[model samples]
Target: MTFEQHISGNIEYLERPGSIGGPVLVMLHGIGSNAASFTPLLDHLPRDWRVIAWNAPGYGGSIPLDAEWPLALDYAAALKDFLDRLELKRVLLAGHSLGCLIGAAYAAAHRERVVRLLLSSPALGHGVPCGGALSAAAQARIDDLQTLGPDGFAALRAPRLVFEPESNPEIVRYVRDGMARVSLPGYPKAARMLASGRLIDDAERLQVPTDVIVGAHDVVTPPDSARRAHAALRHPWRGAFTLVPGAGHALYQQAPVAFAAALAALAETVG
Candidate 1:
């Protein structure tokens, strides 16, 4: 399933169209990731299920947001604009790591726009209030980017995204390639959003059906964090927290079969 790249207004996304009137799935990648990062999961997904993965503002060719320190709501608004331009009335929203924050905001605020929500290795942001200084962790992301540059930053951090880098060289390289594309303004803005995001709060407010999954071996957003987020969901899809085995932070890439099966199960059984 080859994904075709398209630009709708200021947003850039990769799409793999399915049968007419089929279910639509919108994928949002993490801070270090781009739409291309979802490629590994595509082959495992059903060809008839339309999948669209966006390169959040600043990544890929998309323009950066105006606010230097944007919030999850700002990203949600961008997402709304992108969906509006596509004339999509509703969709299945899937978020990974940092993307969970943005997706949670959107799904909570625009409940009518999302039919279901799927989260992977959900990142619990720093939850700093607006106008507050960036947390040490958030600041480190920016500092590392400045100190290492894109390629170096990717090389240094990409392996950490996987459980065992030595065993998963291909996945490591893929993540590295994606992270190496991160540029200024966008990366910093996203960093600030991470500092401000409170994914659990948004999850608690969601009226839409939601499911959360994490890699059993994930160190970034470990199973415990994912469980906490799942506990916060008001309408968990199956009232369960899924942990994909033999996977890590990059579970979608590391355990594509399990990831795809979980996604398909959600679509098939969850209405």
Candidate 2:
């Protein structure tokens, strides 16, 4: 429940020591999500592994970022600076959704410092299907940001991402609150990054082992995109990709036990 949080380049983070040493797991949250959202997975993690979760600029407790900063380049730089500030030379970076985009870019840009990578419910922007509702929905989100600002954008999108229509009201509430807390400027710029981002290409040449976990019922990023990512990795450095059962896009919330099992197993493979 208690841990020392770090600050760098307008981002705030909390680090939890795990049962194993050597490779640390740096977890990143999705757009409109924050460090606190990973609490459930944290419980199921090993104490020996160094676990770090950060609030992306404008989400959680992190300060809002510049509206002009939409490129992954800036985010990748900030992440590098953050790690440098914390004195972590190498880490096992993991992320979900928008966080996955950042994690992939960070790993690719600083291949020397990252030992491995794990992505959950990833939305590989360039790889997202150009046709169908996924494409249409993505466009709609961008349009909404221009029209409704961040609050309205957050209100409209969080539910579709968090749960299915069949989910319980309590679960929906938890997801909604997290999305709602995100500031307007942060959300819009972050969304713009997502709309323009292309992390799968960045992950292609990565030399470290990488794992991708997807929820079978995820409508937001979907399982197909995960499969495409798994295919994109270097042959020898390829990692496992799994689609968890009975979960929507927010697998960490809808089925945290399974998500943790996958995450803990990732820890085991750190060597």
Candidate 3:
């Protein structure tokens, strides 16, 4: 595995190179997590499949957006540039939580580059009650983070990310550590994007194969949310809403085996 700066030195990504001619999987971590969050998932995937997990702008050592509070499209533009720099013409894009929103935006604008998309524990922005409600909710998260700080905020919310946090000490640590790594300067902007993102609209515009997978027990973005997002897809029949039993919002971490299996299934269907 290697971490290198790409896209004219604006983006930093963790990569696991595969054999020549093997398919590529570009993984995007959620708001509070970095590319390392997909470490376990990478371990479970086929060794021959190349994997690239990006530390989205504002997280880890990656650069932050120039805007005070950028929109989802802003993030999408960065992702597109990253892909272009890597010379990846087509790829299997998998995103988690906030990454889902950004991925949807990219797929909508650059349909030809994305052959397949997998949204794991997606955070459906517009799927919330109303625009006002979403904004208010997003503001609340920003407020909490600003007040509590990263360590405090992680302490308060990390446990809620997984089911039976008491029984899963390792996962709890993983969640907390990932959240603690979030950049204070970048998080507020990401929260604003999350609250006001047009993920549903973007999903509806997607022309390639898509899948929404959520942990049945996920409270942050529940099964109902995933179903709604799946229903909004332009090709609902071609897409699917899969529920990983007994898992929670941290589905990828809690059930890496099952989550990887789901991803492999999608890859098999890709042309």
Point to the candidate with the largest TM-score.
1
TM-score of each model, in listed order: 0.97, 0.86, 0.93
lDDT of 1 by residue, 1-271 (tens): 6799999999999999999978899999999999998888888888889999999998888999999899999999999999999999989888999999999999889988888888889998998987798999899989999999999999998998898899989999988998999999899999999999888889889888888889999988989999989988774443457888889998888888888877775575344
Candidate 3 has a TM-score of 0.93
**TM-score: model 1 vs. ground truth:** 0.97
Q: lDDT score, residue 8, model 3?
A: 41
| lDDT, candidates in the order shown | 0.89, 0.75, 0.84
Instruction: Give one digit per residue, the lDDT tens place, for model 2 in 1-271.
Output: 5456776757789877655445587888988678877776766776667888888876666766565546666677778877888788988788898888888888887888877788889878743422223345455765776687656766676677655644555666667767667775676567667766787787796787788899888898889988888889888878888889777787788888888777766655544
Per-residue lDDT of candidate 3, residues 114-190 (tens digit): 87899888888744333344476787888889899889989888999999999998999999999988767889878
In model 2, where is the ten-residue run with the lowest total lDDT?
Answer: 126-135
Ranking by lDDT: 1, 3, 2
